[model samples]
Target chain A: MMAKSQTHSDGDLGDLLRVRDGFVLADVDTRSTPGYGQTKSDAQDDLAAGAEEFDELQERLYAQSRENPDSPAVLLVLQAMDTAGKGGIVRHVIGATDPQGIHLKAFKKPTPEELEHDFLWRIEREVPRAGYIGVFDRSHYEDVLIGRVRSLATPDEIERRYDAINDFERRITDAGVHLVKVMLHISKDEQRERLAERLERPDKHWKFNPGDIDERQLWDDYMGAYQVVLDRTSTPHAPWHVVPADRKWYARLAVQALLLDVLERIDPQWPVASFDVEAEKERLAAS
Target chain B: MMAKSQTHSDGDLGDLLRVRDGFVLADVDTRSTPGYGQTKSDAQDDLAAGAEEFDELQERLYAQSRENPDSPAVLLVLQAMDTAGKGGIVRHVIGATDPQGIHLKAFKKPTPEELEHDFLWRIEREVPRAGYIGVFDRSHYEDVLIGRVRSLATPDEIERRYDAINDFERRITDAGVHLVKVMLHISKDEQRERLAERLERPDKHWKFNPGDIDERQLWDDYMGAYQVVLDRTSTPHAPWHVVPADRKWYARLAVQALLLDVLERIDPQWPVASFDVEAEKERLAAS
Candidate 1:
């Protein structure tokens, strides 16, 4: 219904953005609008509209869990190069709902304890409980992505991790958790502009780390790792959406729309009153 | 600068709403927009503007923490009667900032594990980590309020909790944690209308517990418990703000204003660049 006939055609955003078996990371034009044909302002309006929907749906999800603890929950996994708008999605998109229902975990460098265990051990502990929307800023995929690019893990170890991740995600999805995986696709030139801007502004200095330049130098390796990931781990239960993130507004809009699509499908209903209404009303009136 | 000249006059909102030793719960006019002199629509406009300021100030605080891990963090302790709009504050007020920098805990009735430890033990663990905004929807105050009213704890135990709370708060403040304690004061009539509405709306029934009526019956005791709480815990380190809750907008605006005032006073600065700006820009441009 939101599909406009200006510069874009119609299809579900989930279908439009999902990467199947042969998606080459280099083939995606980072600046292309893809499924969205609207102007920037229109997308902004849609974002606001979608946010209201997210709040209502998320609240229902939260409410349903209160009635039934076994109710379905959602997990949004965000993977991206540095400055690929991961935090922006957290702020402007998921930030629209109640924080009570949103469980957010930002995985930084693994701690000494985390390094000692299987990589997914820390991740397993932080999975969103029922009736909550869980968001992972950087996830277990880092073990495969950075783990591959930096030789942090051996080739055999990296090879087994893809299957481990698929198995883990399958387990989560089978347990009634809806998983939405996103890889923010930004072009090398686009990253240059972003990094350059960060350097140009003193206010954003805290966000810029020298290691970012080192990562930039290994962009192709990261892209290759991402491609390998999509080929190996894009399952029916937990499909990955490769969102073009050169435009911050578009990335936020696409993710919001996709999430709305999933929430709509889940269709969490308002919980039924566990107590008798008539008796309660009379008692309330007396009180 | 956000102070409206009309309904709300010129002193800081922190000073305007802070309760001192002689404060009485029964004397507060729940429906009055005490410090907010503006209409509801005007207050809504201020809320939006303040959200933007909150975003900026909060980012500065977050950024400062990245540079110095030992930076000061904020904790907003919300203690309210049911239907006093604590959830609304979490969704609307604290919801305005980045989730990465915000830590929210909604403490329900403690489970057996929580009861096994001291009341403040669970609370001690979740005190927002360094450089974050921690929000407790209904916090440790529950220990005293419900504990005192229901005789859940011994009378002697109840007497010791006041000093326990003060000492705990003092330790927190001394360790560079700024505590903003709020008690949402609603009248008996207001509670009836709110509870009535919950019972009336099918969608709101999940929020209504028959137990709420039981608690409503002890309104006088809860009020007495609150009076003692304000009398004891309202210290210079963590002063309590008694916000009139019948007017939701004013309570939200006052709390947001109070938080902003603290952030303004803290004056989190832009971190100085650790790397050479020109060198990074040149490297970025070349990449």
Candidate 2:
């Protein structure tokens, strides 16, 4: 069942993929590409075509923000399990655009200094400026996901983070940021194959972590934690999208489509030149 | 007038442009493109051609760092007065690379909380990770530039920051970072014209702060402050390159060339695969 009425040709992916109230992660098919009907080659073609449009739209957003400092920005938060293709999405989807227009931060293990501040302190510092597309690869959800399954934080502290994250999302959205939170979903079998391949490949050996396998063993617990996250933190302002990532091509295309949808809705335009164009051109030429 | 022996055809721009002992800000022509024998069109062609090479080199650097976490990173510190084209350099030079590899920080007026820490505390938080190209739009030099000119810090305190900066830079470089400090030099008349253009254009109105004119009034003092900065902090390990920025195209091209030189020197290669690649490929195919 869809959360919202279908409006677009591809149907509203946000409505279809968004985790609604009383959502269950287990019920969603990790192998299915909901509302999208395209072959892998077709998806590749569509993604390639969309790159130029995405680039132009990003530039427009950057230009508009530069001219009007109060303009809004977009933030795409990507969270996924190990081997779920988050890197591919970042490289293929967001990577096609101008680096000048993007603000990306990959949160690793918290530094000693970071742990001293409230969990949100470091996250707040990396929020994109006006007219930019800020991407967070594995965001604040880590505090809840790993913290919940690993019992890193006390139960009471873990409960507080959910509330803190919700409030933080609301505050950022109110301050003119369109937040797009994505969870790239892949099956256990798929992850196993991916990890196995990493072990077999010398080039991918560096990417393979023994810790990832440890977390994989606690998969069900992590899933339960994610269920709670979907229930608690998926607010209207910054709802989470459960993107089936078994097909990397489909997932990258879908993410790009989602970004395009948001940018279309925002409809950022290049600011009209405020100076006399002809006069300025003449002056520049003379100079 | 060479500070170091020439090693390449480009004649080691790092050596030529570097602020050596007894460096005079006034002696360096703001309009000159020293050691670069190219017209504006020729520079543009070179920049376009080098973009792909720069992107590839950056990716290799990123890959190398990802594989070997201890690998060094490059930090490019850009300092310039209002309308001196720091934004242009960022857009043209660094913008051509992967956003994922870039760590860009535009230091605004520090927050009340930031001021509570040692000034370098905020700077340290924003330092680029291993394999990243960290670009600071305005950096630690601000403390000396504004602090000395406006007397924000006591004479003794201002003197202390110089030593502190040198020590801090040495520590970072020792910890595997190649620091490249750049100051975009523009003449008083050039700045006045640029300021006039900003005022003339309504789109640029947001960029033109009335306070810039106030700062312009004290140009001589700022220049004196910059002279001291060049003299006191231009260490061999973390030397400052003063780029003549009157020509925006030339400045952008020169900055890119400078970055290319640093990257060339670093010569990062893709890490050798530790695992059996053929086995991984077969496993991935089978899976």
Candidate 3:
């Protein structure tokens, strides 16, 4: 069930920002508003409105899952440059819903046991169970992104992963997972400013990693790798959306709209009672 | 570091609601707000105010955990009869914080694999890693409560569980986990209204179960089992609090206050940066 409704005046932000055929990473302006004509205040207002809608839709999805064991689950895969507001999207966008309904996993550097297995092995274990909004902070895409840039994996192995990820996405989405893969696109100039800001604040230091600068030095190489990712894995069932990261508020608002699109399409209805309500009420009264 | 500042004009709700010495299960009036002197509007205003404070305190705890591997974690254990608003507490209270900082687990009937091991095995697996606020909707206390009331386990098995729970709690708290054990105390009359209301609404049907009626039939026995649990399992490390839950607002507010107290005591400070700040600034600018 593809979501057909559009609540925003600019139409579906997902469609406007999606990486399609002949997409180029460098060509897209990081600071552009793209489809949104709204001001920062408008974005904030829309985000708050979207959050309320998300909370209700999430509740419906969760309630539907209680009876239907095969009820569909949504997997939101967030891949971004450092300080592109992945954490903010989590807090400001999806954070308004019932915490019980959301399953959040931040994939860090693989543990020894995780490193021993196929990349998808660790990832598949954490897919949202039925009726959940599963979020992967830095997902399997890392195995390819960082893996490709750092030459951590053999070229042959890296080549196999692109297809493996495509195959994996196809399988899970076929098995009732609505995948919303996002790449938060920020420019090198924006990266320098963000990193500098992190360094400026003592409270923010714990979040600033020296390695992020090390990665920033290879900006061109990482951009090419991301382009390759966008080209190879942006498929029908699991297409990737390129959210401009320079505007933190816009990125979060866009992601929230994308999720709302999916849930609205699924249209999870409240489950009918499986028991005799009249008899139960009588028994409940007696008790 | 114990949080000495309380926003509530009424002294610490944690102390007022705590199941302390000479406490009697029958003595607490489920409808009464023991120390809170306010109208429902006042409770609502206070609850809205508490959510903002909880948000900031939770952020500090999460931030501390990032820099210090041995940072403290908080565990909230909720127990009570069905319809006592465990889900409500999860939604309205903890829902106000960053979902990344909260780890929520709702214990169900034991799976074959889980039943294969000790009761605490499944529990231990789900404990919040450092720098998190972990919540257990129903926990190992079930082994003793349901195990005793339904004779699911022998007297010998049930008898062993209480001591086992206390020992397990003592060990975890020593390992930098702050335990907040709460029982949402609701009267039978209040429960009947809640169940009837669920029966009255089609959207809420999925939550209503005939099994709840079966459990309701054994209310006194379950209360007896609870008394035994409070008597045996409540310890210095993991004391229990009975929040009169006839008023849903008070229960959620009280649980939030109890958590604030623990966080206040732990007082997770913003982590100190490990790197040379000025050097990093130069390095970041060059990149």
lDDT of 3 at B91: 91
Per-residue lDDT of A272 in model 2: 65
Tell me, what's the RMSD of every candidate? 1.8, 6.0, 2.0
Interface RMSD of 2: 6.3
| Span of ten consecutive residues with least summed lDDT in model 3 chain A | A1-10
lDDT per residue (tens digit) for residues A1-287 in model 1 = 13332224356778888888777778888998777877899888778877888999999999999989889999999999999999999999999988989999999999999999999999999889889999999999999999999999889999999999999999988888999999998998888888888888889888899899999999999999999999998988898999999999999988887788788889999999999999999999999
Which stretches of model 3 miss by more than 4 angstroms? A1-8, B1-8
lDDT tens per residue, model 2, A51-151: 77788788778878876888989999999899999888787788788676888889998999999998889999999989999999998899999988988
- Name model 1 segments beyond 4 Å from true: A1-9, B1-7
Per-candidate TM equals 0.97, 0.77, 0.97
Candidate 2 backbone collisions, by pair = A202-B275
Answer with 1 or 2, whichever has the higher DockQ.
1
Q: If the candidates were sorted by their TM-score against the true structure, best first, what order would they fall in?
A: 3, 1, 2
lDDT string for model 2 (B117-141, tens) is 8879999988888999999989988
Ranking by DockQ: 3, 1, 2
Decide which is better by TM-score, 1 or 2.
1
